[model samples]
Target: MHVLPERIKSLRNVKGQSQKELGQALGKSREAISKYELGEREPDPDALVLFSKHFNVSSDYMLGITDHIENKAFGKRKPYSPELYAFEKYLKNQDFIPYLQLAVSMKDSHLDINSFKNPINKLIKQGKKQKHPK
Candidate 1:
């Protein structure tokens, strides 16, 4: 069986949400949700993102690309750490060539990747301060 249909149905059932309710939450029609669960249709990318956000599971989990439901780094929770989420989103949307080049340059310069952590952490702290100013 295809994992998408099974996972969607299972997650809906586990959440005690009827197809109508799930559809309402996802801005999809109940019939559409049923079709998805029956494997008669596959969700588009937008719907897939909605499903992932609604269920708090990774897209990989929904597609069965990975068995792990929650990202170990984030755990199963809402309001994921903004800094981490932003970084993750950035990485997902970016081309890897620049990153690869940077890595090679860093190696040539004898720079440790770990050295960036402190500066990144400082920026995160600065962002928090700005967001929640005293």
Candidate 2:
């Protein structure tokens, strides 16, 4: 669906920016910005990265994966760097079990959208009080 333009405009309004001002931050001409906001043309991946960081939104949010920005996924994660390419190649060569294991390990290292145990959703340490005064 063509949800990006609408959401982008909404985000711009939230930031109190004019199209030209937003374009400057995003390193685009005002006309290009207008076209993107009008849904005349979609932003390319590079521009999408810039938009995500500039707007403090996620690529998923911009792409309309979920309506709530809180559900957004972050990370530029460009798979073009030598390290990234190597990892990508390694992933392509991996068996499913290894991949699953690596993902589980990653959960210990970084929080993710589908990770139920992400600390953001965790209960902090506070003594539980008895409901009926046991």
Candidate 3:
């Protein structure tokens, strides 16, 4: 039950979805979704089923029975990568969503990570200054 709230929030953030977006997709209101994440309310069995289907995760995982979010019935799920997970957290913490979107858009456009070096450096400097102002 505790894990249900955490998993819901984690999955939503990982998918870059706001509560309103997820609620609309699931036919629930944004406030309901908020309550679910806040642990103020628990979803019914029907809502649980919808969540599993929408997130491609198993209900057992959502219930904290498993650490993996795999749904074998759907197909062989890809294993989670710790590095990718860490990078995702880093991006969220650093508020890099816009830059990440820009980087993703540049993909297959004959650009490399090197193309973002200057911007990345500037962002890092800004973060440092914000953390420790003179």
Candidate 4:
């Protein structure tokens, strides 16, 4: 399946948009849109992000990882959640990418909560030690 091309075309059709119209909306060229739908080129990250946002679809769906258009697994995310808000602030304070990688790795690992406790506590201790060494 030519996922990107097909998906782009399908989404454009659903939105009742011509390639030229989509290009105008996205500040791109009609030729660019044609190339994307023809699978002659792939969209850059920014363009992909734009498309996902504009269509209210997941990047996974746009990339063909999932058939579902909306990410139902995320359960209709609100604009804000207390825990996520706090976590985002925490990430902003810390080295975001490394912590993001760690979080993703842990989530992907599916370890038991008990199993995670020791590693998490060790990281906390390390942060404290770095903050103030005796």
Q: For residue 120, what is the lDDT in candidate 4?
A: 77
Best by TM-score: 3
| Candidate 2: tens digits of C-alpha lDDT, residues 30-90 | 8998999889988999999888777666677778875545312443443232234345546
lDDT computed for candidate 2: 0.68
Model 4 ranges off by over 4 Å: 71-134
TM-score of each: 0.54, 0.51, 0.59, 0.53
lDDT by residue (tens digit), candidate 3, 19-126: 999999999999999999999999999999998888778888778887765745667554563236546567896467777777787886868989788988898799
The order of the candidates by lDDT, greatest first, is 3, 1, 4, 2
Candidate 2, pairs of clashing residues: none
Candidate 4 clashing pairs, residues 3+ apart or interchain: none
lDDT of 1 by residue, 1-134 (tens): 79999989987876779999999999999999999999999999999999989977889888988766674346864334334544566667545455557778988999988987777578668867987999
Off by over 4 Å in 1: 71-73, 76-134
Against the unseen true structure, what C-alpha lDDT does each candidate score? Answer: 0.80, 0.68, 0.82, 0.77
lDDT of 4 at 73: 43
Q: Model 3, stretches more than 4 Å misplaced?
A: 72-74, 77-134
Q: Please, what are the lDDT tens digits per residue for candidate 4 over residues 64-93?
A: 887665633465643432234445657787
Clash count for candidate 4 is 0
